[model samples]
Target: MELTYLQTFREIVKWGSYTRAAEQLGYAQSSVTTQIQRLEASYGAVLFERYGRTMRLTMAGEALLPYASEMLRLHAESKEVVSKQSAGALTIGTIETLAAFFLPPYLQAYRRDYPEMKVNLQPGNEPFIIEAVKEGTMDVGLILDPPLADPELHTVVVRKEELVIAAHPDHRLGGLAAAQVRDLAGESLILTEEGCTYRAMLLRALKEEGVEHQLSYEFGNLEAIKQCVVYGLGVALLPRIVVEEELRNGRLKAVPFSHPSCEFYTQLIYSRKKWMSAAFRDFIALMRGGRGEASKMHE
Candidate 1:
């Protein structure tokens, strides 16, 4: 009848060994064995059958799996809800691009506005961040444009950029004001690994144009790619915001082209069912107004 006993039964069946389940649960093996015994006695049915080192779930245990899992899930969800209602720590998810450039200033201004708010930022690409917010693991997410819409999530446009080709200072097309798509033919290029929305878009464009190039290197970190470019490795196509500092410092050059410039937009996304605190409202309002007003000054 005790929830802990049900939880232990589920864990024992899940792991298939009492010792392994004990290690996972941080309990002694004897303690784990006793817990299961108690559960079986209370339920008046054998829950597991031991075969050598492994424990197989009996019919009674198999029948109880779904209900036990749901009970734990509901308990966890209830705890999370209560915690959020009491202490207002907002967890925001974001992608590396936005986390690097956009978040710092906004976060600084936000902290000044609401000093009491505890804000946690979780960084991931569009898919990961969207799932976090959709599942209530994150309060909000600043992400690249996703391919599909989630009815549970509401998205507001944050900022947009025109993607440009970039090359090291020493590359032949480096100093040029702009280069045609064909100019990059057969050149060694740097790109991120797959699952990146922008990289996928760039690949699609390249295939459509029949441009031949060598993807000589791939990097998981943006900073490493920028450093590689500074060392005169190869060219890359990236959002301007990501390389603004390198561009300003003369370490890299943006190669404009007659080809269609890839347009990327950042979206402020959150679940429609989420309860926005005072801090959340202020942060959203600041992003919507601040990004545009700040850009006009650059023009």
Candidate 2:
């Protein structure tokens, strides 16, 4: 009956655990249970079932998810439609690399104008960011990945970013003009965590080429991987933007590795059905990096 209940219900569906949903929504577990109970009473159906250790949506819950999603979307739309456009809050989901290397300048510029705007930068994997954007929880999703296609969200290719192999300046591969897949045979590779898009592409290409690689170290942090590479630990595949400073300063060298599958881009994503507020429009326009748009945001 209450919009809060539906919001909580959808959060439960997203996380698949009462505790996790509660934590994410900033509600106590008991409060989450109570909201679900009230929602079930309103609908006269059991919404979830215990499945092993986690929760699974019941048939009734499954049927209600789309409706709940729609309700939330419309609720958000109405707020945007009626509220004064001051860019009150903008939530962005992105990966660590982009969060650290790519977005700071843009955030600084945007905040300079909309100093009162509440901006939440939620760092996450590509898939999670996409889903958050689709669900209307995140107002925008900024990611560095290959082209994405999804009916529920609008995708924009901001720019193509070269993927590079980063290595210590003194490493053996540092002298290569361009390192081919075969050139990396038997080399120790430091890589990002499993959910990384470029990491998957790199591994797959190596596998297809039947190039044997030594996985020396795995890390979730870009700086950690770069630091490891600087230690002569191993070469790491990362966005050129990420290693630009290190390469410029002689702390790291670009190994000149090129792979078609590893090609990626900086992209923007937003829900297709959600309303875009004036501030939201300005933010997107600003990200488009057009002279006209950049000028508008400052004005």
Candidate 3:
């Protein structure tokens, strides 16, 4: 099958509409239809199922998705290699909180030292970031305590971040130096979305301690969570780095919590088999507070 056909198929799957995919690919509607027909005719399997106005992927389409993605990735890499376009270009994936609080200084320092390098930062949940690294779509991933043990990936611990229960200054638990999980039983808890690593840890701690509480609000954005807490909506468990400014400004109070899971590590991770370019190596070294030999080249 042609690469353009595979690309068209992937775009159709992403948009869930043939017309939308055609619009995005700058192809006439008939061309998209003909391409899909040719692709299905060659494979002898139906790729997509049409139900009136809606379209959904068939079993064949589901099976083809991963291979299509891999082929596209390899094609891009080959072009980069042939054109020598990969150097000085780094793509990193990370979680939202780290993108906000932890990465700024290190990124600034790296840019100052290697002004010729180009950095692209993409933020998502832990699994999304890890998958991007594994697929070679991202050069590296910075995540918070990824739970899975993948033999293909190597992880380096960057730092352990302390988690604390944060609330408005007027909250009753605000004055405590440290509080037990059970202490939050009667309180309303503001939480991040389900995929958040720290949120998962916090829930596990409460469950193990037999503390039942109400989830007052669930937010996907860290700033929104902080704002809700500041307005006395609820107490939330958050990384200290995320709340440092609010804590210092007296807008929020971080009460240290008594739990083993209160501390989670930030890790820099990448595929073990992936080639380490000088730029990638230098970035990893910067994150680890080590100046690798690559640093001397740019100097």
Candidate 4:
């Protein structure tokens, strides 16, 4: 099948209509229909089944989806390899805290060094970032304590961040040098929403210690959780980087946890099969402190 035919097929499947796909691809509706017919003729299988006006993918179409995506990706990579332009786009997925506290300087440096390269930063929780990287939608991901058994992705520890239990300055744990994991039992806790890696780690630690606590509030934003903790609403486990200002101002106190797992890591992750462009490589080097000659750009 021709690349254009496969492109039309993919677009049609995505939009679920020849008219819409044709509109998107700047082709006539009849041309879109003809391209799908050619693709179906080549495969000798019905790719889509029509139910009134709505078209859905058949089994054959579902099976062809991944292969079509791979072929398109390979085609783009091959073009990039042969192209003289060294600068391209890089999309990075990260968590909110890292986007706010950790990535600003690094990203600013990258932009200065490669002015022609476009950088897209998408912030979300760990699971969303991980999935984006795995699916090839994101060029890289900065995640926390990634899974060891994910064979499709490669990860390196870029930074070790301290995790601290923070409470209002007047809270009982504020005066202690270190609090036991069991001390959290029955205490009101403000935590990130479910599926957050740090929150999951905290829950796992609590479960391991057989300490059950009240999850008093769940929030998606780190700042909201910090505000809640600062006002004595509840205690929260957070990265030290996110609460440095509060801790310094004495608005919140870091209740050091006795558990050894209180320390966590920020890991740089990407797919193992990804083609590392020069810009992408430099971005990784920047994150790892191997800036080399690129450091001059910051000056």
TM-score of each: 0.69, 0.90, 0.82, 0.79
lDDT of 4 by residue, 78-173 (tens): 887887546777889988888998889998999899888888888877878887787676889887763333778877667677778899999888
Looking at model 2, report the run of 10 residues with the lowest lDDT sum: 290-299
Whichever of 2 and 3 has more TM-score, that candidate is 2
User: Going through the candidates in order, what is the number of backbone clashes in each?
Assistant: 0, 0, 0, 0
How do the residues 154-261 of candidate 3 rate in per-residue lDDT, one tens digit apiece? 777777778889989999898888988888998999999988988998889888888889988999999999999999999999889999999899999998877876
User: Cα deviation in Å at residue 22, candidate 1?
Assistant: 12
> What is the C-alpha local distance difference test score of candidate 2?
0.86
TM-score of the candidate numbered 4? 0.79
- Please rank every candidate by lDDT, starting with the best: 2, 3, 4, 1
Cα deviation of 285, candidate 1, in Å:
1.2
lDDT winner between 1 and 4, please give it.
4
RMSD of each: 6.9, 3.4, 4.5, 5.2
Number of the top lDDT candidate: 2
Expressed as tens digits, the lDDT of each residue in 86-189 for candidate 1 is 33567888878788887899889877877766788876777888876765667788877632356877777766766677788778896677776678788888
* lDDT pick, better of 1 and 3: 3
| Root-mean-square deviation of Cα positions for candidate 1 versus the true structure, in angstroms | 6.9
Instruction: Identify the leading candidate in terms of TM-score.
Output: 2
Taking all chains together, the TM-score of candidate 2 against the true structure is 0.90
What is the Cα root-mean-square deviation between model 2 and the actual structure?
3.4
Give lDDT tens digits, candidate 2, residues 20-80: 9999989999999999999999999999999998899999999999889888778877876
Clashing pairs in 4: none
